[model samples]
Target chain A: EAGVAQSPRYKIIEKRQSVAFWCNPISGHATLYWYQQILGQGPKLLIQFQNNGVVDDSQLPKDRFSAERLKGVDSTLKIQPAKLEDSAVYLCASSYLAGGPNEQYFGPGTRLTVT
Target chain B: GESVGLHLPTLSVQEGDNSIINCAYSNSASDYFIWYKQESGKGPQFIIDIRSNMDKRQGQRVTVLLNKTVKHLSLQIAATQPGDSAVYFCAENPHDDKIIFGKGTRLHILP
Candidate 1:
């Protein structure tokens, strides 16, 4: 009955620094996703996981961004050598099924600022 | 190369009035659509959804209309309140799996 949970609602880092965000999804949910929302834009899918296996990560910046969903319950998204363009809100969401029309429950996103 | 986009970037409406937000999608294969509301500091929350088979669906205070012909989607909010002030986004799922979100429409309710 608890919704998805995320840590460090806000974060600030200098360019070239590294930052990581954590997410704990709702119980029994099998699909977890990470998205980036720039100011005045919609959330863009960064990665998606289904029970510890990556379902999709076509938009993820492989050179600078990485994510893992170990044990299939919690997830962590990391960005190394952050750039000014990386300053955006990172949102986490979970759904009950891996492939369905089920609604996704989102967590309070982590707002990251790179100086 | 499918994308979802909104017709309006922002909409202003008087409180107690109704609001209609429109979106267009390029993927004709999309079978599912959803509307989400996001506050200033929070992530998007699900408002309502409509499947491609159905032309319309209604919730407590929200209604979603889908037109497969023109690939158009719309959300109607009845008796809009101050709480309805937020950014609304429409997402499309081509295969009923992965979803693509629109840029979003900022809704401002004037009291």
Candidate 2:
């Protein structure tokens, strides 16, 4: 079985520029998630999608960040006017279920470097 | 504001010895706990998990212990190898809620 897939394993953008990351979840997975991992810190949940609907995005900065899952399969996360603090790895994960001790399989992640 | 956190930032264990990593969570409502191993430049890989109803769960030389009284979680690796060197993360989730991850503990296997 193939795992979660993400694009542009690495990205670099100037401050105030916009950047986007793409993700394709595992086949038949019902839940998808996006997380940000800063240096020396654990990955923080940014948003979660159960099928085509959002399950949670309370931690996401709405002023700069946004994400969407289309057709309950592919998802995209975007950051506008990126700040230096936005330099971190963006990870995408997918699970077979929406809840209950589900094992989420993660992708390699897209490393974003905002200069 | 409740979050999961590791007891230590880094732990160095001699190869072939047993390794233990500790974590503490603030949310009592969290019922499911999971441990993930993150290698350099790679995303977190699931190690094992234990439910609130379970005090201990073992899988392939790895064990997870959950102490509900203190809200503490621990991961134990037997006969640690160099391949086991990586950051270990503990995550918690309430029933049908989002999973929250802890800072992580970097495990260094020493020769």
- TM-scores of chain B, in order: 0.98, 0.97
Off by over 4 Å in 2: none
**lDDT (tens digit, per residue) of candidate 2 on A1-115:** 9889999899999999999999999999999999999989889989999999998898899999999987889999999989999999999999998766688999999999999
The candidate that achieves the highest DockQ relative to the unseen native structure: 1
Name the TM-score of candidate 2. Answer: 0.97
- Give the alpha carbon lDDT tens digit for every residue of B1-111 in model 1: 899999999999999999999999999989999999999888899999898999999999999999999999999999999999999999998874687899999999999
In candidate 2, position B110 carries an lDDT of 97
Model 1 interface CAPRI class: medium
In model 2, the Cα lDDT at residue B25 comes to 97
Chain B TM-score of candidate 2 stands at 0.97
* Model 1 TM-score, 2 decimals: 0.98
